[model samples]
Target: MDTHTGRRRTDTDAADRPADPAFERRLLAQVERLIAERGSVLAAQGRSLADLGDVEEFAERMVAALPTRHPYDESLGPFYDTAGLVTWLGVSRQAVADRVRRGTLLACRTADGHLLYPSLQFGRDGQVRPGVFEAVGEFTRRGVDGWAVALWLTTASEAFEGHSAVDFLVLHRSSAAAVQRVVEVATADAQSWVA
Candidate 1:
């Protein structure tokens, strides 16, 4: 409820609210600038940015493709904070931090810079789903930020048979080829970031 108005908060209100129009554009502009700067550095080293492949189109498509319906879109969350997760997992705070730092656990930083573990990382048993550590490590190893990794994993892909990577991992846990395919896609995504 909104204390001042004595009314409940609803999805309708959220949908009615105006989103920040310039945020995505600003981010796109920053990425474009980064690509240009990278191109400059590569040129100095006798290389070309052409290898990145249609950088502008790639950036715009990614931004446009961002999922618009997640609960996170409404709130930046109470998403599995470390202290709470430690209780649930029966581990010390240091262990959780270590896992996140090592990329064995997926975590994204809030605007205020606290790491919040996405709820998707946990299964119904309160354990992390299999193959998560490997996938998270793959992205982090190649400079893909945690938030982007989380988004990529959640997005439905035709490559994963119209399912997200998480579902594919769960359903194909025993298939070595399937697991390897996930890793390969992660590597490809990393290559995009490397561009």
Candidate 2:
């Protein structure tokens, strides 16, 4: 039974439903939430969902546009699988996803469709750095992918004076100025990347 629409869901509802109903439902919900959230801003900017045209083509193009993985990827990980993150943070899997959605944690989907969080993001204290939340939130808000966000945080940036964001963040973890710098540069970088 469907409470929101007062209509029961039936197998015949759509011939195009994917094989995994649960995964499909979760993904659909995420997309709907994003669309609803971004719809107004996109409209004001003279854009519409139709601008994406074909979903498959859009996905392929987005994938193609991502920054290439550099050698830094190996240093960025010791990634935490969902189960390990759940045990480490004492949070449920859904809670983990919620945090990722909120941009307070970094997660990138593996090729097999599982989310993995880098151990480096939490440092040794089991807490996400202050600047990280703001930077990632800005990046994701600008329509950048999570993989790109992770890469941006790890890759060396000449703008940061030959230091990666993670390095600068660690060196000045408690500095408000540094955090603001991260947020500013992150949004700028995200804009250029999307453009």
Candidate 3:
């Protein structure tokens, strides 16, 4: 039962739904590919399969050795390339580059070194949200990578009563104090690891 809505929750609700078999198959395939790639890399480094000890232990170590994927990688996005940003913002490509250089816009760099900006930073008016630049500045100053900052902004947080910073900004545009508080807390937490 959903007390807030005064309605009975149904199994049809997304949260209660079962995983899609096709998605599960894709995930398993990716895991297999990852293990194979890792094994090949190990062989090239002069460590054969025999050196990996037991097969179960080899699988465990290979999985653990895989690099963490960015959280946003799973999302279907309106991610902006440099050309897309130039058109969307009604600005030149150089202007977009300048904003990135100034840390006024957060962009993730691909392994190929191209920048992609998530569309969530833009308001309905197509302008950058007021506190976004400041928040990005704070995170970058504290040495947080762009992907980590993007993940933090999109994730719901109990610290803000379960609203993600981006959602909080959309709902409370007149003030970004909530988002600012989240940024400060993230910066402090990052600093603690170094200390």
What is the C-alpha local distance difference test score of each model? 0.68, 0.69, 0.64
- Report the C-alpha lDDT of model 2 over 121-156, residue by residue, as the tens digit: 775556788778788888877667778888888888
Better of 1 and 3 by lDDT: 1
What ranking of all candidate models by lDDT puts the best one first? 2, 1, 3
For each of the candidates, the C-alpha root-mean-square deviation to the true structure, in angstroms, is 20.1, 17.7, 18.9
TM-score of each: 0.57, 0.59, 0.55
> Top TM-score: which candidate number?
2
lDDT of the structure predicted as candidate 2: 0.69
Per model, state how many residue pairs clash: 0, 0, 0
Candidate 3: count the clashes: 0
- Candidate 3 TM-score, C-alpha based: 0.55
Off by over 4 Å in 1: 1-78
- Candidate 3 per-residue C-alpha lDDT over 1-195 given as tens digits, one digit per residue, 9 for 90 to 100: 432222234555545347699988998899789767978999899886577578764444333222222235465234555544554455777888888777788888877686778777776566667666566766766667778778777788876578777777777763757667766766665577446
How far residue 151's Cα lies from its native spot in candidate 3, in Å, is 0.3
Better of 1 and 3 by TM-score: 1
Clashing pairs in 1: none
